[model samples]
Target: MAEVVTSGAVARTVEDLSGPRGLPVVGNLPALVRGGRPHRTLEEWCDRFGPTFRMSMGRTPAVVTADPAVIARIHRQRPDDFQRSAHVSGVIDELGGHGVFTAEGDEWRRLRKMATQALNMAYLRQYFSTITLVTDRLKRRWDAAAESGRAVDVLDDLMRYTLDVTSGLAMGHDLNSLEQTGDGLHRRLPLLFPEIGRRINAPVPYRRRVRLPRDRRLDATVREIDALVRDRFAEAARRMEGGGEPANFLEALVAPLEGESPITHDEVFGNVLTMLLAGEDTTSSTAAWAVHYLAGHPEAQRRVRAEADEVLGEHAFPPDPAAVGRMKYAEAVVTEAQRLRPVAPYIATQPLHDVTFETEQGPLLVEKGTPIFSLHAYGARRDTVRFPDPEAFRPERWLEGALPPESLPFAPFGGGPRFCPGRNLAVVEATIVVATACRGFDLEPDHSAGPVGERASFTAFPVNLRVRLSARR
Candidate 1:
């Protein structure tokens, strides 16, 4: 456990940092691509080449670090010593998602303030029923599947459930994807994240030159999303004109703040898009991963079920925040799931200035404008000293207070100034869903449901993780 040494100059430049040797001009791009999930490969590399080292994707030279101290410092020094990767921001902006997540400098500050207010716990408390309503909808949907012997596509359906929750809370409307199916925003959203990842890792922006079908579909999805957001904004505006208070997130964005001019419609839309993007895949993926682990570890699942039954009593869902708060075991399971299988496994950032980043290995000089991958997932999970059995899915460990002081090194929402705004909403959504599912039904892993695989896009989601829901008899 080494601290960041900024005072003294212990030196080793990017040129001096050791990493895997690459062939010709392509560099380590093929190894990364062939490695399947980039996060896993990055972790493997971290094990091989100390904590901090260099790796290139084609001609792009980037530094990768799984050191918690280095990663925390990187996140805290945002828009100063470091910032979100320019290439990532450009990709997000081009895809119509330039909001708090991608905005830099003063723009980021402004958006962060508005975004923070909208996601405050007070708002989430007001919207507690929305979480319950969405959770119930999911329960009913799964009930139908269980009764009819239809296998549940846990990740796909969880996306719909999360979208419903976010839409009700953020847009002040019910965009239900649970009952309705095929070619809706829920279906469109899962595609958007993976595409963003593909573009980010691409050596050449070849899709721009020769449009693939996937690219065209992404274009259509963005257009539809833009239209949907505008419609919601118009409704919020109409409500404001009628002298109604700012009820939901969209209204919060549209309603003027003191000493500030009204935000542009584009900005409003961008922020709304950011909320949906932040909420959808991240929560759904985490909840899905929890389900995967629970199915395999029946004792943990049973404990979660018992806790949910006790906390929820006769109700179908947790009555309030207090009630959900009482279900310690279930929440522990969700927290463990987050630690083991984080959605955004690594953060993509760039240095704003030349600085010495101290790792357990040693102090290394990182140049200005260098792309950085702070593998926070690897930091928390891979540290055998902190987490003895890093690979095991042991929810009870979380119950036993196994994590030591300052858990931000592996916190799913991240740490420092840019911590996730939608974290409260995401955790509640996941916790409620996990509770509801385990309380009423049994998640039986299907033997014939193809190979269980994983794909790392912007968020890592379970692939072909088909689990059948059986009525708890």
Candidate 2:
């Protein structure tokens, strides 16, 4: 591991870091374009340049690292000395605007406090019934596919399931995106995150200057989402006027506090959008990948099913927190799946001041505005130095008695203060969904749609993931 020099020491320069110096004007853009996925390209660069290196995005200087120590240090300094890169935050601002996810400094602190209160353990406990209801809808959808003996698009179903859960938890309403068809809001929600990702990585700020067809559609979609959220806020406000306590996240945000000023209407709208984007894509992607892994690994599947049977007995319909807690192996399975395929593949941060970054090679100086990309998925799961047989799915790695060392690179939900607050909810939701689905049916991958590949949208998710369900006795 690279050692950080003492505070007063001179910082290193970009020339000191190991990385390819591409064309004069374009820098690494051509290579990135040729390499397809940015994370994979960066991972390959890590292999060649050791754990830390320098790269460029157009004229902007960037540093890429997969070193856990370096990533931990960066995360620890978040919002103080290290903040979300301007490019990343700019994209999110355009999509969701100044919510908890995109806010920084005092604003971020305030939003985080409110959001954490709304999504805390107590609130999560209240969400179990809602989760169960959503899962029941998913079960019925899968059952129909099972009876038809046709492969179902698991990713699509899982996305719908998550959307339903998020809607119920965030707004106390049931969009029924899973059961309903041709819902404009449901269709548009998925596009928002991917478009944000596209704009963030685009070579030019084309959308800023002109509204292309896709940009026009995205604008319309965002307006629709805004209208829906605004209506929910109004409804919640009316209910509060009638002396009702807050029932959902929207209400929680807008409900008056004894001391603090009430959150503005715009804040409520922004945070609601944040919740939907954060909750839907990340949870669904992780669950779908877990299903994919379980489908391919029958032994693991059997173990999870057996564990689910013991924990859930004959009533696995609404997985209560207690029941989900008891399914240790099932939790391990989900953890392992997340280890292999983290939904949010990277964490991007920028230093607030000149900083010395510890790396495998040595301590390197990073300029204040340079974007630093920590490849979380690759670092935690695929690094040969940390995880043995990095490519294999081994749930035992996360079992209670067999857990890996805490120091090992295992950041599925990031690290430090910036760690995802929704992690517990995501894990619990995935565990319930996976255990329930596996208990009810055996899954077989439909590889005829071509190999199960990963596509990087707002989250990394399984692409072409079709699975045939065989009802279990």
Candidate 3:
């Protein structure tokens, strides 16, 4: 029932695809900018042009798809054929070098293996105390803010919490950004990620063409970040050489220097940047959005609190990883939050070879070099057909006896080989934060201010999220 069309050297003709036609050279740019967020615009287009369509950003051709089957196929079958788009990879490589997040093929494989070993479940279990310490510090700060009876910036506080946890776990240093008041490396580090996102989505290649003021600032900030990470890596290496046990990611990376196919110092540096950038924004944004959702739904919040209290009875301060695992309802809350508000909205990939995607409409031949934007967040996770009552905040949907087949249309962490290596860590970290926060305090939205809106940076986060917290009775 599907028609296949092939032209000379190319796969499908431009007319074969359905999408918006824009002005000359800058196709779809205006629509994307006017819609504010590209993923939202793509979702609108998906509604208009079926599940799959073609659009252009400037002169670059792209295939946009909302179909879970197509997305799953692309993710599962053709991982080697599809990789990060040039623009996305270029921006990330420029900022963080060729780490696991940006690397392709064999380089990615090597870096991913090392990163996996470094942040494996065992390592995360070991690092639980570090996460607990940082989270306790965050709780203390919230306690102070609660006493003031003023709305606190939820995203900012969660960012500080994630920064402390990530820096402490990865670098073996406590930034204490939650309590510290000065503009230190911890503060400056977050600025780089958003800027990177801006550059990636910019219509004009300003970062490549000319040295803008922001570019210079990014360079300076990156230099500071690099110096701090390098020093920490060196110190970690020194400790490892002195017969000290490897305590953190840096030390874990250094410990394998004597192993076969050991990662280099430069790889260590790049991976450290990768972990910091990837770890902080995604986990913090998930936690913030989860809190926002829970604030609006008091019954759900009460359920989560009850579950936390039941699971983490006496040792709730620094919850053991095993105990944390037993908090099913809490995990369900985090999972549902992720389903509603995915941190990375779109996953961009480019085909290295000609490929044909089987769509419900037909078989579409995709040529090499065509950028494929899998609008995973809007397309799959929020698809009303896939998820009944997609807009509702229902953590029970993730509890046992809810959905049996968890594949397709539910890839919060993307899919296939490039599935987020830090998936477990992110989920565990968010679960701990949510469970601890719910058990310790009641969070209410600051109705004096307007409702929190969503913003797409490197990750999608709730913008201007201010919440009033009170100690639980």
Candidate 4:
């Protein structure tokens, strides 16, 4: 309904997507590098030039969209037109061939379908105890610190919780990551995961040409994790052969799919590695943001605690999935937190074939091989058309239906068919973690650091968060 701005009238140097660029080959690489976080800069571009816009990341042409309709059409209606970027695809291939997250085409489809079975509505119930167990452990750690009259590094503790939950789901066994120490195999896995993502995204020639020190370390870590996963799969296979009950995701995956390899040894390893890496960091970051925001908003925190008390009552953690579902305010808090701080800020997609589509605004024609990125979590949220007073944290907006569900206005978990399969798990994990923490812990913002900010790595996390926590009075 509002007039969309164009690059001609705007002061920015990058070429606009709406019109043919009158620019040179070097493209916007220099400007992109100077802009610091690329997602924020892309958001600025969307603000200046409607939802669909363009820029060049090096010689590669990139189209960015904030409009939900455009994103949906691109991902659902015209999915065949798009493919994972070569950079991302190559990285995945190197990590593990055709793992669900990395694989495309039939390989991705089949693997995703199989993976979903483990994470489906039915299997999720099995994780309730694990989530509660891990969160309860974290609460005790925080309580111990409170008794000692010491400040807690909430980030570190939350990561421990995430690692424990991830290990439980992936391996059918808890690693007690919250109590883990030493630079041994268990610790190396989490450390290497995000660093691999960073290395993959890094524009380093040495990433492909020669092994950097970190690369070698990452390779060694992957091998170690692979061995662990292989051993687990072998044990599961033996148990299944001996007629044992299925207990974890690894077992489900290893179980047969009539026409397919139930799960290859590498597939098992890849899935385990994928789950461990993705599960921990993203949820941990979401939990971190949840604590940060609630601490800053006492009234909201009180409401969250009140709901937790009613739903979970006297329990140290959320009771069960059914009970967790009843805590609407808890869900809203996590949603709002994620809306403000999505872990994966921006995602890149390249088209396998040229495509054209029509929208309420106008027609879009993306040439074959063009790299398009959707800034799903940035200005898209703060955009007035998408969310009113978008900068403010108001959990009630969701209850009030201030924003439409179909709107791509806030895609912390992304949009379309490619929308994150793990989103449901993430929501559940965040709600329980935040609600339980508020019930027993008094978290205060670390004012000494001025304000907690972030560095966009594989996931966006608090760059230097130092918060003080004490027992709830």
Candidate 5:
């Protein structure tokens, strides 16, 4: 059995490590770009080459580790020993989203606390009503679909619900994307994560050299969203000046936008864009996947629905923030979904200096500036030793006292100082959506739509996961 890689041991350079063969110059770039499910490819490589092995992209040194312990160590290193890979940072910056997700060093330090606090549990409590409102809106729409005997476009509708909640709660802007006929932002959000992955992996950034029509369209959408966010900031500034208590996230984020505020317009605006893009896609997909699992596991669906009924009484959505927390079974469903079908299946990190990682396999020295791609879902999905019947969707595995006392391999939210700032909000938001779906409807797999499988843009989502939503017996 392979062991988690640790630090301090006799050293062997990456050149001395093992990996799949590559073309003279292109190396593994081809496999990454054209491969089926790049995350799964990395996981396969980890299984083949042991933990902490080397690969390259266009002749540039890259590393991959499937060991959860090494991934946790990499996370703890943070902006010091490692940081978000430059490729990812560049792509985010290109999209005009350079907030906590893309910030580094002093800038990261400055933005992290603010962004984290804005979505913390307390903030969720403050915004829970908005979530509940959006939840009801989604239920109303699903009710219409159920009444008509239609297969719900589960992923698309969930995305709209999350966007509606995020817009209302974060900026006091009623995007109401769920109800919007335009569907402009709705079209744009799904384009981003895939593009982020493409640009990051493309050996030469071919789109940048010769922009395609799709690229131009993406640029237009990004510009539109940016302008919309700026307008919201201006609106929030105006409201705060009128002695209105900070009503939404934007209002609370900016303090007296008139003079000498600690945060910059760009930082605040970037974070807003980040939240808008990240908030809708990740949680919605997570909830959608939870529904996907529930559709296949009727017993699990029953348990989740029973739990939601107990917590919610007769409410269509979580009645209060406290109630959201009390839906432990529903939360576990999301956790298990994250384990089996993590929205972020993998994360990219890099070594800031030459470093030695001691694996039970052995010690390997890695050089500075090497891009380290850690396939986090490998442990959650592949480690049968850690999770018996690893491929199974068992929400009970996440409940209190279900596992032994050891560091969890789950990295759905990333980990350490730079762990996802919006994690609490995402989980709470996803839990509410999942619980409501279970409580209000019975979901059955829409086999007529075709097979459902994992697709990765950046966050992995179930492709063709439409479901039949019917009122319960």
Candidate 6:
């Protein structure tokens, strides 16, 4: 029997560790790319290999885990040992330093508080109508494309909708990319992140060694976005100068904090970009999968349709928060879709201090500076300890309180103090999108485009999601 080892126990040998041999500088770059469906492949390796595994990515030694008890120890019990991974923080620093997603210790606390205040349930409820408006707009576009007998890229449309919502409600700028034509700032948003994401995920030499023509274009687009953000921040500052209390997250963040560092102007710009990048696609992709699944499974579609009918009536746009809240199956569909295709698959954390933790298999040593990866997707769906028949896309699992609290089997939004602040917002947004889309039309799975492939980057987006949306009677 596997010993349930804790921090006090002797540091036992780590069991699951099967990685490819590598050179010093370019450690596993070739391997990481070669192994497509990298998440699932890594999971298979862990299953064959046990608990804690070691892998090297271009000389960076990484420790990966899928064990529930071990994940709980790092995220919950001995959380101090697990700080944001340096690699991850470096990118965040470049992108948006000292914000809720990147800041550590007191700085992290301050940003988290501000973000929590701004992104509270009340604010999210207020934005519910905006989310519905975007969803309806997207459906109309899709319906038009379908009626024209044209193949639509569901991924692109979803991106536009979420980008529009995030920019308007959170950033206080009505980019209006959801309805407008032209390859304006909004069209550039999706392209900007992926190119930067590719550069960040690449090894230093590899990232620097190769500079494509597209890099210049990507940089130019980024500059445009920065210019826009700076203008907004300046306008906000001017309004504050006029003695009027400013509104929206952009304005609120510029105000002073009690005894902590107020979010700096640089940090504000970075976080605005971060919010656009981090918050949008994850929600959109999950919503896309939910719609995909609900459409194929007519029974599930009926449930969502019933919930939307009860809550939203025959209206195209959700008029109120009460309508958003009455979406039980819609909520369940989002939950199950996340379980099936989580946007942020694996979250990496590095320990601040030396610590030890327990695992179902045995005890393990977490050195002071070791990088630890809490593979949320693997844990959420694979851990049978939490869900029965883990692979099935059954929203019913969330129906009768089937999930446990705080374990590997249950970390879609993560656990403990570092849990995602935007979880509720994501859920509500997803619910509105799924329910409203269901109400507007029926999604039929088009097998011709092939299965959805998980595109890895800073976040994962479902690729090749070619589904046909037909008008509902």
List model 5 lDDT by residue over 51-75, tens digit each: 6678888888787887767788888
Q: By TM-score, how accurate is candidate 5?
A: 0.93
- Please write out the lDDT profile of model 4 over residues 1-473, one tens digit for every residue: 22333432322311334522424665665455343455666667677877777776556677777766766666674246677676766776687734777777777777777677777667778877888888778878877887887766666777888888888888877788776666666577667656755655555546777888888887887787777788888877777777765668888776776687667788788777777777888988888888888888888888988898898777767677788888898888888887887878777787787555454346565667787776667654667766778778888877786665434656677666667777778788888888877888777777675567765555667655666777888
Q: Model 4, residue 433: what's the lDDT?
A: 82
* TM-score, prediction 4: 0.90
**Would you list the clashing residue pairs of candidate 2?**
none
Between candidates 2 and 3, the one scoring higher on TM-score is 2
**Candidate maximizing lDDT:** 1
Give lDDT tens digits, candidate 1, residues 1-473: 22335557456667677798876789987788674687888888888998888998677788998787898898788866788989988988888789999998888988888889888888877889888888888999999999999889889889889888888877887888888866677677667777888887787888778999989999999888888888989989998888866778998877766776799878887888788888888999999988888888878878888888877778888878878878888877888888888888888898888888777766777878888888887766767877778888877777676565335567677778898888877778888888887887888787566888887867777888888889986
Ranking by lDDT: 1, 2, 3, 5, 4, 6
lDDT winner, 2 or 6: 2
lDDT for each residue of candidate 2 in 143-218, tens digit (9 for 90 to 100): 8989999998988999899898898888887888899888578877888888887887787887778899999998
1-473, model 6: which lDDT tens digit per residue? 22435655655433234455667788756566553455665666577655567777776677778776777766674335567877777765654433677777766767778777767777776666667677767778977976876665667777887888888666678777767888788887787556655665666635346657886676677677778888888887778777764466687777766876566667787777767776787878878788777767988887888878887766766676666666878888898888888777677888787555666555665666777777766866666767778888888888778575335555777778888777777777788778766787777777677886677666777778777777786
**What is residue 326's positional error in candidate 1, in angstroms?**
1.7
The global Cα lDDT (0 to 1) of model 5 is 0.79
lDDT of 4: 0.72
TM-score of 3: 0.94
lDDT (0-100) at residue 361 of candidate 3? 66
lDDT of 5 at 285: 90
Over 4 Å off in model 6, which ranges? Answer: 1-9, 13-25, 77-79, 96-98, 206-211, 238-246, 260-262, 405-407
Score every model by TM-score.
0.95, 0.94, 0.94, 0.90, 0.93, 0.90
Better of 1 and 3 by lDDT: 1
